[model samples]
Target: MGLFDNAVPGGNITKPLMIALGALLVGKMLSGKSAEQPQEAPAPAPTPAGTTSADGGLLGGLGGLLDKLRDAGHGNVADSWVGTGQNQSINPGDLGSALGPAVIREIAQRTGMNEQELLQQLSTALPGIVDKLTPNGQVPQQHQVASAFNS
Candidate 1:
C-alpha cells in the first residue's frame, strides 16, 4: 500500500473529511463579517450649562481645587479654612471676598506688620505673584487677589 493510503488506520477518509469541514465552517463563521459595519454602543447624554462633564457645578471646581491642594501638600489649608469650631467655614466662592482683610490681619498678627505696610507690600508684589500662578501672564483678577494673600 502507498504511504498516503496507510496514513490513517483502516484507510478511512471520513474522519479527516469531517475535521476539514469543521475547520472550514469555523473559519467562515469568524471571517464572514465586513469591517465597514459600525458597532452600536450607548451614547452619553449632554451636560447642562454651568456643569462639569463628570460632576455638577461648583462642586467640580472644589474637586479640582482639592486635587491642587493635595499636590501642594497644603490640604490642611482647606480643612482649616472650612472645618467647624473657632475657624469658621468660608465658601470657596467667597474666598476672594475675605482674602484681603484676612491677609492684612494675618500679617499684622504674625509679622507685627501694620495694616498699611502689609497692604502696600501686597499691592506691589501682587502682579508678579499672579504671573507665577498662571500659565500665561494673565490670571483672572478675582483669583489674583486671593493668590496674592496665599503667597
Candidate 2:
C-alpha cells in the first residue's frame, strides 16, 4: 500500500477502490512495483527533472497520468475531471485504449483484476475521484495533494 495507504481521500473514492489506481499510475510508475510489494521490485527508473512535482511524488505522478490521458486523445475527458464544472464520463473500452495494452496488463497483474474489470472500475470511479482531487479546478500542489490523501 506504500504512500497511498496513508493517503486515502474521503471523497468520491474509497480506500479499497483507489489503492489500485494509486498503485497503478503513481506507485508503479515511480517505484516499478505495486505499492503492495515495494521491496520485492528492483529500483525504479529515474524521472527526468521537472517531469513531476517539486518532490516528484504521487501528485506529480498523478499529473503525469492526466497528461497521458490527454495525450492519448482524451484531453476533454481528463480536463473535465479537473475542471470546476460537471465531470465527464469515459467508456471503459476507451479508457483501456487510452491506457494501452502494456499498462493494462501490468495493472491487471498488480491488482489481480482482468483488463475489463479494471477498466470498468477505473472508468466508473476516475471522474469523481479526479473531481474531488481538483476541488479548485486546478491540480493541487504536492503537499496539498499529500495532505488530502492523508486526511
Candidate 3:
C-alpha cells in the first residue's frame, strides 16, 4: 500500500504528519533566503549645536510675572466692589465687559465655546464678576452714562 494508504481512514497520524512536513519545507526555504539578505545599520542621533543649553529660567520668570499681573488685575476688580451690598446676579457679558472685548474673544476662541455660553458658565462659576464690575454688585451704570454722553 502507498505511504498514506497504510494509515486508517479519518486517522490523526497521516494528516498531522503531512502538515508538519509541509511547514518544515516552507521554513527551510524562507530561512535560506533570509540568511543571504543584508541588514541595514541604524542611523546615529543628531547632536545639538551651541555650547550652552536653552535657558528655561527666562520663560519661567516671564510666566510668573504674567501670573502676578493677572492676580493683581483680578484683585483690583474685586477691591472695586468691597463695600457694595447689592445682590444682583452677574452675567457672562458682565465679566466680558470687565475683562474687555479682546480678552473675552480670546477666552471664547481658546475654549471652543460660544461667547454667550462662556459668559453664562462664568456667571454661574464666579459670582464675583458682577460685584467687581459694579459698586452694587449689579450691571454697571457706565453703559447708560456712555449712551447719554454719545447721544
Candidate 4:
C-alpha cells in the first residue's frame, strides 16, 4: 500500500545497510556503461571507488539482482515489488539463498554486519527499495534511479 510497507525494524544498523546497497548498485550502473553505448540517462556525480565493489556479480545493477532472484525461484516476489502491487515479503533465509554466498559475504564485509543480520535487514529493506525505485511498475531509466537515490 505505502512505500516501505515492510519498514526496516531496527535503527542505526539499517541506514548503513541501505546506503551501502544503494551506493553499490548505483556505482555498478554507472561503471557498467560503456563509451560506445549512448548514455540513456544522465548520471549523478561518480561515487567513490572505495564504496563500490564488483562483489555480487551485480554488474547489471538492479536488473542483475532481479535476475538472481528470478533464478532462485523468487520471480513472483521480485515481480510483485516491481509491479504496481503489494510488495511480497521474503524470508531472510530465502533472501540469502537468492543472493548467494558471494553477494552476502561481500555485503556483510562492507557493512560490518554478520551474515544473519545482513540477511535479516536486507530481506526487509529490499522489497521496499525495489518498489520505490520502480514507482511506475517498471524499471526506471538510470537518471531516474539516480534521482530517486539523490532524493
**Candidate 4 C-alpha lDDT tens digits along 64-101:** 67877898999999999899988999999998888777
Tens-digit lDDT string for candidate 3 (33-73) = 22322341122112122111112111112222123224535
Candidate 1: misplaced stretches above 4 Å?
A: 1-102, 137-151
Candidate 2: list runs displaced more than 4 Å.
1-16, 28-60
Best by lDDT: 4
The residue-by-residue lDDT of candidate 1 on 1-151, one tens digit each, is: 1222422334433322222211111112111221221231123223223334422111123333333334445545444323332222333223322233442343233333465654444333322222233333222333332332223
For this target, which candidate reaches the highest TM-score against the unseen true structure?
A: 4
Q: Report how far off residue 87 is in candidate 4 (Å).
A: 1.0
Tell me each candidate's RMSD, in Å, in order: 32.2, 5.8, 32.7, 9.2
| Residue pairs whose backbone atoms clash in candidate 2 | 7-149
Q: Is candidate 2 or candidate 3 better by lDDT?
A: 2
Question: What value does the lDDT take at residue 18 in candidate 1?
Answer: 21
Which ten-residue region of model 1 has the weakest summed lDDT? 22-31
How big is the positional error of residue 69 in model 2, measured in Å on the Cα after superposition? 1.6
Please give the lDDT score at residue 13 for candidate 4. 31
Model 4 residue 146 CA deviation in Å? 2.9
Q: Is candidate 3 or candidate 4 better by lDDT?
A: 4
Off by over 4 Å in 4: 1-13, 28-59
Predicted structure 2, TM vs. truth: 0.67
Cα-based lDDT for every prediction? 0.30, 0.62, 0.32, 0.63
Model 1 global lDDT (CA atoms, 0 to 1): 0.30
